[model samples]
Target: MNDNAATGEKINQQARAWYVRLGSEQAGADDWHDFTVWLEADPKHIDAYDRVELALLDISPQETKSGVLNNPVGKPEENPSDKIIVLQEKRRLLKPIPRSYLAGIAATFIAALALLFSANIFQSPANIQHYATNIGEYENIVLSDGTRINLNTNTKLSVQMGKKIRAVTLYSGEAYFDIAQDTKRGFIVNVKDTIITDIGTAFSVNFYESTLSVSVAHGIVDMQSPVQKVRLTKGQKAVRLSGAKTMTIASVEIDNISTWRDGVLVFENAPLSSIVPELNRYFKTSIVLMDEQTAALTFSGVLNISDQDKMINSIEALLPVRVMDDGRQILLSGKQ
Candidate 1:
């Protein structure tokens, strides 16, 4: 064999190894850093890795259906060690051919793809991942498929990525979802008894005090309950009250729904009663209305939640109200 052909073969092997290594659970930040260095060391490395990835994608369905790849929802393998032996046998069969031969080249490419599938690069749905944020805390998460999720204060959720679906179960609090469109796999969110399926959209789901609220910012979302199903488009919101079989759909101001993400709350002539509960979500200190009349007062403004004292001062200055802090809680009463 010529030295050029031998060098190309070696580069292909290195690319395959890097691809599998990165897809595995063990790959870390350092591994990724080194991979970048290697990829940039030679332009051929980029082409080689791309070829390996494309080949795997082409053969994945056949391998998955034939049981060569791990089924996302299947039961555990009785003999996990057997997978290594099978991979070794396949490698041995492909290793003896000359690369100059067309059949040999095809066999080698298929062997590389087989190695990836046999290694179980795609995570199974059974491997659910749980994420949470503490009171007054927020978090951002990006999934393997490029979907982005922003968890609001005091939130908990679990994510499962499968071959046909990308699912998230919101156990509590609120989350904004920016779904990456994939024609093959659908994205769905489970909030209480409601199932929200994205149709190439960006949306938010808030579950608080036995109530489920969904607001769509872009594209479309299909929400299904036990009794009914509804589709929401941009500027639309759905609210399902506790113990109700059906949800109410309404038009909403889209910008107001996501202002909390910027550490501020925007209220347009919103009453004190409705606003206080939202403020409580971000702070340990409770804000209580001293009288019914105080709760009835309306305020229209933006309050920065980062500073509790400043937020309270702004509320008092804007409305006909007096704020008293007893250390335990902040009490609001109509100014006499």
Candidate 2:
């Protein structure tokens, strides 16, 4: 064979291998990512994969049902002549093919085409979608699988659904997920180094500067980091600081935890230091504590997030703090 023909044959073999591997149950996110990279590396890879799929379909049902396709390649008893006869009878082959090529074809034919079809690995752009919300804005999204997601201000996330799994990656901010239970395809959410796996659950995940918090309102979810793993159930919340080896799990009020979903911030004795950061996510004007004593003050109330001025006024009225707005930012100081 010429150099060009030899290279073509090598690519064809690789395409067949990828088809078999992807159809197996062991295929994962990394496998799919690698396959996509390979497919896009050269246009000929697409054509080669298509030929392998067509070749598999051309095989006779009687031969496939008889378990001839399941036999491993390079078996001494397996006859390449038998497959060539079937291909020739089906009018798919115009000339004689090599025995080694026939062996590769037989091995690839063992995988069901249905799995490949469901995967839709080639149309990656369509399979993966991104959603985001601007500051002071909230958006609701319902996925095809009936999963509902409520995105808080300045939040960004991506959803990628595969044949065996539904994955969401939260880039920043907060989101509440009402997952649709699928026993065969598990739901997972990824935030930085943390992984949250849903088990028929409704939960909220918040990813701020140096903290990651997961609060479960219903059902259960498993949260895992590099060094720790914990299962959270209804009314439970897990908080982990950046680079921490362990997470702090505590019981919480689900209603109070999810009040942000209703366009309100509910705080029960939450410190001014923590409240300022939450408010900063919604408004363009940054909130700054003028002193440590001011930051230590606690407030307990529900404040409407829609109006920034009203929220600031409510905080000033409810707590012993003075708010000073210099047009660019708001400064909070303990009352004299």
Candidate 3:
């Protein structure tokens, strides 16, 4: 109401914009450094930053929408920076949010907002958001455009919700896409060295430790990389290996690999080495074999995806092995 309050509000708004921009991968090193310097330069900067941070601390991320945050003008334009490129790199390192925790995030956020306003120390910013998931969690989210995404654990993604060109970057981990049919706008998911273009289809991309895998369930996906480019149909999967010139394509038993989406773990002749990643992914457990011989053995079985114990039990049953849980790690060894 007063000029000072109004001025503070304006500065707060600008600070919020900077925070959201920083969330973008397009935000350059110089820009981020400058922004950080500027923030630390003034008291208003700290106040504004704290306000925005408090607002988003509990708010979970939503699915990416087409033209969601690029611009509100509803027009096609060039990407001014390497945001997409940075996003691709981030996606390769992130995973999805868990369903159990996401259910409470909204309520927690609303409460936090109310408390912030009651204190009246800082005004919350609505447009900017920062989302993250811990280990062993996953979530399905709906974006503004009605597009849906199933986020995996230990993932960080930021969405710049706008009227045109909705954009999202996977900061880490894996995800499954059931992109909303937006033929006019199209939905795109970026990973390191590859871009996934879709229109109303179900697909899963796993980017971990520099390895990227893309699997299509229903409909089609155009996977483009610097080395290889191809269109994938249902029941198809492609993996991009580090420093490899060619991407490996295989006709996969879809149900076995993708059953995680349905809470089922189906292993159709999948090797022990191949299953390690999936086990590490589903449970917040670290499994290391003491001997290379144990690592080389193959596994074949179907375990309930939702139950980590059952899956591990199945693993122990099939192999002569010893399992140890140290709370921080799970080690498997050959006993028989």
Candidate 4:
């Protein structure tokens, strides 16, 4: 690529990063300071930022018909001579702009935004709010719809509330939901091909190793796909294996289930393979099985997460396995 083309591309990327960061509630005074410094670095930087602002506005532009209504045909207004902060503030930007200047910036940013979308550097939908729990972490989230969600370790999801329905797309991992009762509006969770619709319920859904499991503790839930539908009620569980045509429903002891809300993990004849992956979510280091034979071994137990070492020892005692801790990674092999 030519030097100017490469340079413009880099500027656009940097500007987009700054734009996203600044929009977050986590952006603090230091972030704002760094952003202002970056904004003042070069003239091309200003152009790049303007493009970012314009693209963000374009992301949701129903109310502000920014093209024809805001920017009309005219000579570009002269830059203010008195260092006015209202129109072009150092900290708060893109509030008020000269019509002609805004038109030029919007045109340029639209081109850059198209490139960004095509390259896949930006994928967040305008209306969706994203939440995630890092490995070894758990969080309680309250959505705009007044629904409560307990996100387990290594989980990521997005929420979008509408007038008629509340939708969430679980990208990965697990969560327990205390969905608010709304007869006029229903709650839905989209996991792979399965669409979980709630009927005023509290439940948990887990997506692991391409398999989806839904457990209803209270009320009823319907897991629907294009081919089949399964209804689950209190103390009931359903599993949809990857590429399966229908879900298998079973019964669980709701009172004894070790849910994330209580910080307990209950395994019912869970294989070493499944247990190891779940354990990794609560610890910084991972436990790796030495072979597939070790992974196939099954054990049933309730693990208290307060002490991870105790749980590891319990696993080792139940199965004929030895725990080899290497500080960074844990290794499990058959006991001699």
Candidate 5:
């Protein structure tokens, strides 16, 4: 083993010894002090000790009832023997029958540690590869599993593929996925607090504020959160508001929903407040609505996102509002 690996093994051995000694009635004051000093000396020592205690509980439940997990090193006794831990360990080996049985117990401890290490590895943001689009920029990505992802403007996502799992976490904006079938491995997408599991199908997810809207173009998906469970099929859409126990379901024209990926955004009765944000994503110049009344106004139409000035003028004609262009921005207010 290399230096780092060798050091890790040494810490595990020390932690195992300390755990057993503290559990018995023979641990002295010096044993407890040495443990505290070792624990304080390195941050990894504490983690190692925790794993040791957990492993003992899993392999030896009867010992757990003895209160080995009470404090810094379990409950301490005033009159304790330093040999108590050594004698207890000897009693365990007196009944062993074969080499394979000893190996099995060792494997169990290693497996428990492997699980902890895997969780730590995935918790780091760097584990997954990141893909993001700037304002007005769109992208098409083909994953290793033959999954096609089309990202809309200002969208960000992360993907991590393992041997038996494919996981993606959507950070902002929207995207469309065409997933390939893999019966042995499941595909999971995380949106806000909800999890979307694809059953060999394709879908789209839009995240805005605390709400997430999922539209399925083809196939089926199971959407779940803390308090709600919903299954959706092709040509169906669902919207979930933050803190709501249930989702609002509706049928949609799946063909026109994600048209923005092709340079066209079609909105059916979309609000002014919502429209302005979509417009801002495609233009460097910002659109500001002056009043709440104007923001609540809704309109329906197809917008060509390529031409910002024409789109702004088009909205001005559709709504009873005046649009003014200062030297820096466009301002809209109820005609007055």
Candidate 6:
């Protein structure tokens, strides 16, 4: 093995020894101090700790509680031979088992690497990629299972695909999923801890991190959480808290949610306080309203995102306010 690989193997072996010592309360104070000192000595020490933590977590629960390593010493402490016997027996039993587990992890890592290195992985007829737009940027992506995804503004996602299954993880963002229907194989998108399994549905998922908001534009989407699963129809909305696994269903007005897809934002009975942040996201400009009273007032109207001047005029028209522009910053207040 190479030097780095050899070092890693040695660390893994030491970790098991440390774990046993920790379990039996046999690790001396000096040993614990030394380990801590080494851990803080280099960044690689932290990485090694993370790997060992993963392996420990992956170990079978039965193996952990089996009391296999009752003593770090080979035998009972009455004599020197006891320590030798215990040490020898422990090494023999643990060496083979940990190597086997490491081999399995190596195999999975190799397979993933091969798939990534292959030139035709994305070009295959069976695989489709999906992409989406950012704030002021557009994208088109084809998924590994032939699904297309278009995302919009401040989105996050994870992708999983192979011959058998295709999955995407969307934590907080908006995405347009153009699912390619396959009877034998299905595509799924994960939102937080929930899953949106396609039932031949072409739809869009808009998720907000701070608020529990899920707006569905078209098709029947299956949303599954830890406690419950629900099928959402077109023009239906799901809202819940950030930590909540379940969603509350509501009938949504399609225009309000879908308008953002068309470069228009409409605020009906929306507080000026709420509107400022929305405007900040759509435009490169920063908007500040000096009057808290005016910011609290609710405004109802549609604003085409393309025409900033017109949009500003419309907002000012409704409120007794004046807009002053200073570079990219705009201040709105009571007419003065």
Give per-residue CA lDDT, model 1, range 158-200, as digits (tens).
7878776777888778899999999998888987657788999
Kindly report which residue stretches of model 3 are placed more than 4 angstroms away from their true locations once superposed: 1-130, 160-164
Sort all candidates by TM-score, best to worst: 1, 2, 5, 4, 3, 6
- Score candidate 1 by lDDT: 0.75
Cα lDDT, all candidates: 0.75, 0.74, 0.63, 0.70, 0.72, 0.60
Candidate 2 regions exceeding 4 Å error are 1-125
Better of 4 and 6 by lDDT: 4
lDDT tens per residue, model 2, 1-336: 999999999999999999999988799999999999999999999999999999875221110112221221121221111211111221221244456555544443333234333444634756677766656767777888999998787667778788687888787778999999899888888776567889999999987654689999999999876556799999999998654546899999989776777768888888877777677777777777888898789888887777788788888888888889999778888889
Clashes of each: 0, 0, 27, 0, 1, 22
Mark the 10 consecutive residues where model 1 has the least summed lDDT. Answer: 61-70
lDDT of 3 by residue, 233-272 (tens): 9889998765453578887666645555565566767666
Q: For model 6, how big is the CA root-mean-square deviation?
A: 27.5
What candidate 6 gets wrong by more than 4 Å, as runs, is 1-134, 140-148
lDDT of 2 at 85: 15
Better of 1 and 5 by TM-score: 1
Consecutive 10-residue window with the lowest summed lDDT within model 6: 78-87
lDDT of candidate 6 over 166-265, digit per residue (tens): 6676655567787888776567776655567777766777665334455666677777655567888888887655554357999888767645555567
Residue 291 of candidate 6: its Cα lDDT? Answer: 77
Estimated TM-score for each candidate: 0.63, 0.63, 0.58, 0.59, 0.60, 0.54
Collision pairs in model 1:
none
Please state the error at residue 42 of candidate 1 in Å.
Answer: 56
